[model samples]
Target: MKRLIPLILETLDRGLTRVNPLVAAALWHLRHPTRRGVLKACAALPLLFVLYVLVLIPFTPGIGDIRKAKIEQPARILSADGKLLAEFKPSNREWVKLKDISPNVVNALIATEDHRFYQHFGLDWRRTASAALHTFSGDRQGGSTITQQLARNLYPDEIGRAPTLTRKLKEAITAFKIEALYTKDEILETYLNTVPFLYNAYGIEMAARTYFDKSASELNVLESATLAGMLKGNSYYNPVLNPERALQRRNTVLAQMVKFGKLTPAAYQTLSKKPLRIDFERQTEPPGPAPHFAQQLRKWLAAWADRNDYNLYSDGLVVRTTIDSRLQTMATQAVILQGNQLQGIANAAWGSRAGCSNGKDLLATFLRETPDYRAAKDTGLSDDDALKRVSANRGLVQSVCESKTRVQADFLAMDPRNGQIRAWVGSRDFSQDPFDHVQQARRQPGSTFKPFVYAAAFEAGAKPSDTLLDQPVEIQLAGGEVWRPGDEDEPSERPITLRDGLAYSRNRITAQLMQTVGPNKVARLARAMGVRDSPLEAVPSLALGTSPVTLKEMVSAYGTIANLGGYVEPVMVTRIEDRNGEVLADFAPTPPQQELSADAA
Candidate 1:
């Protein structure tokens, strides 16, 4: 700028030389001014520049509003073993506090970006002057301090990035406000958490994890230097993209550390020669092994966050669930192994003409149960047209006939003592079929309901060794209809023990037991043992498990027997914590209640 002062004096003499004789004569006289005039012009330039920058203070935003500026962070779901199940409403940033960050990262960043970070208020005048000198020689330098860079990052829209004098003025003013409002440590914390790195990574935390598969606190000196060096230009010094450039930049950062007294000269020499090794794996939100479970938990968590006044996507929360991944994986494997055989049997029964006795009728029934057929009917299509329309969609037809085409099952393992659900598999494929059969689908409990009837009878003073005649039972309804059960298997005409009746799933023996104990007693016992979600009809046919009940209810009911007649409601999430590792909520274990006598159970 000093070199341009004489040229500006000369330009005024040429452009206005022809315009006015007196102005050009005055300019010519000013061009050859005294040493005092030259010294005053040079002295007044910086003062004028300061006044011009001070005028931009009013235009600057409320940079001191640190009380409300929140960085959006994604919540995480983890299993009992601390394995990441999925990230809910995931983002590419993790806000790490200054304390959690390794000091090596701080030293590296200060050494490479701003050495006078602690000493400067907002700007380094000495470095700025040198940068100006370098710019004149065609070697540009970034004269903005860390505070200025952070001010730009915090309000990128307000402090525009275009290389204009006006933008720089606002940036400088905002940087001053930020420096006054926040501490040096706060600035560094926000700067490290806000800066962007390669691979959609933001913050030193994410950058460290993206390249090294570790948290910010776990970064070593060499790793910290490599990550800090990328702040110059993320893409240019990306370890995975350009290893040579990254290595060289890392060496420069190491040298800076040695110069700043953070690292010994001997250590720098040894560290600089080490190769850049990255664990670079693109991080994506995995559905985990419990997709259906996680999906259901997500809905519940949304409601929880709503009631608690927190944003599910932006507020960083760690939800610790009762789900054990080991048991979950084992249950998933069990379902796949067992469900395939059941599917084979179903396919062999329905896939061929000989297996399906009423193939046409069954296909018609399954087609009518589909939403596509109902949608076609709603659009004024007749039954034949709707059937034709549904059948035309091969994928839809296959899914509708998934009983034979796809094997779907639900498996839930719970710790009976505390009612903690350890594993939950709601379906074979949550992507293709999301219907959760565990608690959502209400189907007949089949012979599983017999245990409740037997328990009720046992509570009524009937022993397991007691014998009964295994014969078909009949009951006359109030509507004057005689009801007779059509048994799936023929019962032996001999007398059967109460234990054998339940072991063989003998409906006749169960019906006789129901008649002796009464239907109301059985329904009451079922509800008391955690089958309280739906109404259980007090009918005699309930002995055959005719009423529909969810798998969750049946499992809980069975768990009651295992718990020595004590019933406890199943628990899913054990606790929730905030981003700072503070316990926001802790869901204590639910106490168990006695439903029946231990001997009866």
Candidate 2:
């Protein structure tokens, strides 16, 4: 064993000599084992310490890029007039400067969180020592200063929340580094902006607006104390959820302020006695003007960002859309009014049918398709128990069905002159149904597609006064199949003018016109008019608008007719800007494509 030890030591000494000579020499001296050797090894300890310090110096964290520590800002979507349409804040925070926050808030925060905030470089040694002593004496407590907390908030993925000596050491180093990099006010500002408040609120600015319906600068002493108290543990002291505990914490902060000489004892007492007043209505995100259009713009922006290597969420972009706010509101109201009327008729017809009566069977069908029911079945719940469980959740199932079954509508209004989208209504409620029917969904246009067929007939040298038989017509397909087209009323052998056939949406007359012009030509004209995405087959049924097309495409096609002959591609976004107000890009309408002559259109 002694010989093996020498061999191991020799191998380590040789390896260490190539890496670190001081360490290798110490190891060699220890292996030799003499009184002089031991003395020499003791002498080399200071040199080893100096070498260690020198080695770590080059690898120290840099502090030049403080901007990298800034929290994410929400991107704003604006209308043509610069009115806010929607704001996409995934982090749900609004950054505010330290100077903007009330002095009362700053005082309350310093008193409660870190009394020696100004005196200490980064870590408060006196508080840390006291906290460590308390921990050793069995009352465990945290000794982190505001700087330490700020460091953790900025780099949570690195300095984690694990209660270990290693994590604490890293946190201390980061805190000291932060102090070296930024001023006290800067640290305070970053901390206030990064800290999480309860109810999904992050940062003092968001918390202030959420609870008080006022800006951080407008907060009074009591309000300031209330917000500061949440820094301890926001979930435990949430004003909305636990008012009593929040009140106690607020009083504690006020008391700390008195102790720190930031507030007088009489003022503290008076503030502590006041009741906590929070406006709950202000907590939720404000409803925007055009959500569907915003969502569609978000998708387009996302694709543009990917192609251009830009960030949509963090980079504070100002997206200027072509939406007219007044027109959008009117369009939304129209869709709601018309959709409700249609929904009432539909509900009266089908909502009270046999299987749908009382909605029990529908609820059961929905519940059976749920993951909870499947989990219950998988976990050995008997059929009877599963049924009981489903019965217990009948109200929830019913609510879900009602929400899903609400009548949806889509509307789009565009300027035929410039192809700028004036207004768009994608669905009844964007929260319930995010599906953009105008841009994303394809539905049968009914008789709305008749204009293209008539335009094709005119292009094929048929006049508006040209007459066609308004009778039932049967056409044979290539595969020996027959298609019989008819109008809503009884068949009439009377002739109708091409203009009247299109005006009344006459099916048989339009079918005869489609045959005269050729169905492929009609489809070609539809594409030229901006119905580009959905392919149209040259079938005889195309005359009666059997093919599915989006509302956006229909609007653009009709817009072409309204413009007399030229087709203009629809324009939504007008421009985009960066955080510093630099215009990144501007959008313009595509050059008009002539689909038909002026008289033909």
Off by over 4 Å in 2: 1-76, 88-90, 94-186, 197-200, 204-283, 302-317, 341-405, 429-434, 475-482, 515-521, 535-538, 578-582, 596-599
- lDDT value for candidate 2? 0.83
lDDT of all predictions, in order shown?
0.85, 0.83
* Residue range 1-601, candidate 1, lDDT tens digits: 9889889988888899889999998887687788888899899999999898777777777743433343555678989999888788635777889999999999999998899999999888999889889988999888989989888876788778898879977887888888888889999999999888878787898888889999999999999999999989888998998999999999999999999999999998788889998899776444578988888898999999999998787778999999999898999888877887777787786765223322377777888887888899999999988888887876776666664356668898888898888999888766656789898989888788999999999998999999998777788877898777645777667899999989988878888888899999999999998898978999988887888998888888889899999998988899999988899889888778999889999
Candidate number achieving the greatest lDDT relative to the actual structure: 1
Q: For residues 1-601, what per-residue lDDT tens digits would candidate 2 score against the true structure? A: 9799889998998898999989998897787789987788799998986776555433434464235556455678888877899887766677888899999999999999998999998889999999999999999998999999987887776767788765776677778888987889999999998888866788888898888988899999999999999888988998989999999999999999999999999897688889999875445565577888887877888898778776777778888889989899899999889988877776676464221333356656766777777878998999668756765775655565555456779899899988998888898877667788999999888788888888888887888898987787889998999988787699788889988898888888888888888888999999998799998987888878889989899888888888988899898888889888999998877778888788888
lDDT of 1: 0.85
For candidate 1, give the lDDT of residue 267.
Answer: 96
